[model samples]
Target: MASEDLKEDQEVSFCLNLFTLRCGHSFCRVCINQVLNTKEGSGVYSCPECRAEFKEWPSLQRNVTLCNAMENFISNNPQQEEITGISCTYCVHSPIPAIISCLLCESSLHNNHLRVHSEEAKHVLTDPSSSIENRKCSIHKELLMYYCTEDAACLCMSCTLAEEHWGHQVEILDEAIERKKEKLSDVLRKLYMQRQKTEERVQRLEECRGRAHQKANREAERLNALFTDIRNQLDDLEKRMHCEISRQEEQESLSISDLIQKLELKKDELSRNIRSIEDLCNMPDPLTILQEPDMGDLCDPEEGEGEEVTGYVDDPEQEEADEDSKGDTGGDYGFQQILHTLSNIISDVNVVFYGQRPADILLDVNTAANNILISDDLKTATRTDKKQNRPETAESFQCFQVMSKERFTSGRHYWDVEIAESGICWVGVCYPSIDRRGWQSYIGSTNKSWSLFIGRGYRNQCSVSHNKSELMLPYQIFSAGVRIYVDYEAGQLSFYELCDPIRHLYTFTTTFTEPLHAAFCVWNKYVKV
Candidate 1:
C-alpha cells in the first residue's frame, strides 16, 4: 500500500518537473534543451562540471525517474479545505431555505421571521410577509411614500422633503459605480506616463557616470607619466652636481700647493744672505802679523855714505783697506738697478706728451689785404671781420690776397721761418695776390725764445713765444731760416737747420708786444756780416 501511494504522489509532482544537467545543476526543460542544442558535438558529450570527455555517448534524454520522484513529493502534500457560510447577499442576517419566495417584495426567507425588517435588509431573499416596509419607515420609523434620486433609495415622504436631498443631482448606486470606474481608468493612464519619464532619467544618469569614470582614468595615467619624467631629471641633476664639485676641489688643491712652493724658495734665499753677512764680520785681518820694514838715511853725510831709518806700519791701514772693499759689495743688492727697472716698466704704461692738432680755418669775406685785423681774443684770427662770425670760421681767421681777390681752401698748411741772428722774431700769415704777391701778414710777440703757430693754411696763423728776451732781434739784417711750429694751442717747438749765407747784425729798437714792431727781416740783396 505504501509503494502504491508513493507512485501516485510521484505522478502528481512530475506534472511541474524541471530538467537538470549532470553538473548538479537544474533548470526548466526548455532552458536545458536550448543549451544542449547550441553546444557543438557529434559522438560524445562533455561533462560541464569536470570537463571530462567521453566517447560513444547517447543523445540528451529526460530523466523520467527523477521527474517522477519530484512529482510524487509534491502530490503527497495536498492543499487544505476551506469552510463556507450562507447569508443574504444584501443583508446582515443568515438566511434559511424553509420559506418560499415573496410575492410583494420578491424575496425568500424562513417562516416565523419578523413581519417587517430594517431598510438595510429590505432587499434580502426573504418572504414577502417578512419584507421591510412601513411600521413607520425603515430608516426613520415613519411610513415610506417617496423615492429620492440624491439619496439613492426609497425614503419617507418627510425625508424627501428635507434639505438633505432637496436639490442635489445625485444618482442611484448603480449609476455611481459606473462613474467611479471611468475616473479610475483615467488615473491609471497618467501614472503610466510618469513611470516612462522616470525610466528615461535613469538611463541618462548612467551615461553621464560612464563618461566621468573614463575621464578620471585618463587623468590618472597622465599624472603617472609626468611623475616618471621628473624622477629621471632629478637623477641626472644629482650626477652632474657630484662631477662639478670634484673638479673644483682638485683645481683648488693644485693652486694652493704651487703658492706654498714659491713662498718657501723666497724664504730660503733671505736666510742664506743673512748668514753670509754674519760670517764675514767674525773674520780676523791677516795683515796683523806682518813685521816692520827698514828706511834709508835722509841726507848723506858724504857723497858716498848714507844712513837709513824706518817706522812700523800703522794697524789702521789694514782696517781702512778692509772697509773700502766692503763698500763695493755690502748693503742692498742691485738696489738702484731694481728701482730703475721698475721705473721703466711704470713709465711704459704712462702717457707723457701729446701731439698738436692742425687748425681748421675758412675764408672770411670781409677782411682786406695788408691791413688785415687779428683775432680780438687772439685765440682765433679771421681774414675778414663780421659782426657775428660764422661757426666754421669763428674760432680762426681766413686769409685773403688783395691782388688775387681770392680766399684759400679750408684745410691745414705748414710754413717755416728763421732769425738771421739770435734775436726776437715774429711769424704770421701772408695773403697772396693773383700774381702770387704778398699782401698781408700777422705778427705777435714771442713772449719767450720759442713759441707755437697754429691755424688753417693762408686763412690764419698764430704765433706764441715762450721767452721774452728772444723777442728782441740783435741784428737788423737777417737771413731766411726754417722755423717749424705746431699751429694750435698745443705746447711744442721745433727748429729747422739753416745753411744759407747770412751773418750777425744788431737791431736798433725791438718790441715784442705789437705785431708791426715784432717782424723779423729776410735779407734781400747780400748776406749780412
Candidate 2:
C-alpha cells in the first residue's frame, strides 16, 4: 500500500512486541507492562476499554496477526517515515532520536552531555525542529514572536519595540497565520464553485454545437436528393425536345430534295428540245424533222406539270401551320414549361426550408388505433373503414390516432406532417403517460396533451385544443402540411402553417413534467411525417 494509506495503522501499532488482553484491546508490550505494574497490588483490574472487571492480573498474549501486519507495513513504508523523522546530529555511530534543538547553532542534539553548549538565552533549546531558522528574525537574530502587518513581515520582540516598524500595526505570529489560512480557505471554495460552473457551461456549448452539425448534415442530404430529382426531370425534357427538333428537320429536307429532282427533269427536257431545233437547221433536215413522228409529244412536256412545279414557294406562316398540325412543340413551348417548373420548385422550396430543420419521425404500429394502417416504411398512417385484427394493449390508442415511436425529453426539435386532405385530421404532441382506452386518452382530450385540429367541422377553419378548450382560427390555411415545434426545457410547443414563408398557427406554454411523443388523429386519408 502507499505511505498515506498505511499511516493511520502504523501510528496505532508501531512497536514490535504487541500484546492483547482478554478485553480484545491491543497495545505495545512496554505500555501494557507499565499500566499493569502500577496496579500490581490491586485485588481487581479493569480493561482500558469496556472497563471489564478482572478478579486477578490478566495474562498478556502476543498478537501474531497484528505483529506481522505492523512489521509488513513498516518494511514497505520505512523510507517515507524516516525522511520526516528528526534525529540527533551528534550521534555518529547509529541513528538516534533528538530531544531538543538550539536556535543559535541551528542543530538538533540528544543533550546527553549538557556541558558542551552555552547556558545563555540565545542558545536556548526548544522542541526538535528541522527548520529552526524560520523561528529567528533575520536582522536581530532573535526568535520571531510578532508580525508587522504594515510591511507584511515577520518580526522579533526587538524589531517591534525598537526597529523602524515601532508604530506599525502588529499581531501575534500564530494569530496572523490562522487569519490568512481562513481567508485562503474561503477563496479556494469560491474558485471550486466557479470551476464547476465553467465546466458545466462548456459541456452545454459542446452539445449545442454537435446538434447544429447534425442538423446541417441532414439538410444537406435532403437538398442533394431534391436536386438529383430536378436534374433527372430536366434531362428527360431535353431528350424529348431533341427528338421533336430532329423530326421537323427531316421533313423540311425531304421537301427541298423533291423540288431539286423536279428541276433536273425540266432541264433535261429543255436540252432535248434545243438539240432537235439545231439538227433541223443544220441538216437542211426539214424532211427529217417532219419525218420524226413523236417530235410533238417530245417537244411539249405535260401541260400543267411545269406550272405546278414552279408554283411551289416557301412560306413561313404555312410552315408554322403545318408544324402545329403535326404537333411539334420544339419552339417556346418546352422553354416556357421549364420556366414554370422552376418557379414552382423555387416556391415549394421557400415554404419547406424556412431556416429550420425537419425532425425524423416514424409511426409506432403498436400504438395505432384499431382501423389505422401504417405504411410499410412506417412513415404514413391512414384510417381505414374496416377494423384491423390487432390485440388490445395498454399503449394502443382507442380512437383514430397514433403516436410516433421516438420520444423527446430535452432540447428543441420540429417535424413536418403532410396532409393528404385538409380539415380531416389532428396533429400535436402528448405526454407518454396519457390514457389509452377512454375518451380522456384521446389526443387533445385532456390537459396532458396539446393538439391542432384541422378541417374537422367547418370549411377553411382550424383550431388549437387543450383540456377540452378550443380556439378557432379566423384565417384560412392553404398550406398542404403543418410544422410542429417543441422546446422541451423552455416548455413551449408551437404549430405553424407549412405554407410559403411558414405562418404561425398557435402555441402552448406550460411546464411539461414528462417526455413527449408526436401524436396524430386522422378520420380519412393519411398524413406522412
lDDT per residue, candidate 2, 355-467, as tens digits?
Answer: 86677899999999998999999999898988887886998988799999999999888898888754388899999889987889877889989999887334757889999
- lDDT on C-alpha atoms for all candidate structures: 0.38, 0.75
Tens digits of per-residue lDDT, candidate 1, 218-244, equal 555544544454455446555655665
The residue pairs that clash in candidate 2, if any, are: 423-454, 423-455
| Superposition error at 305 for model 1 (Å) | 78
State the weakest 10-residue window (summed lDDT) of model 2: 304-313
For each candidate in turn, the TM-score is 0.25, 0.38
* Residue 92, candidate 1: alpha-carbon lDDT: 37
lDDT of 2 at 185: 82
Stretches of candidate 2 off by over 4 Å are: 1-135, 163-169, 246-333, 342-421, 424-529
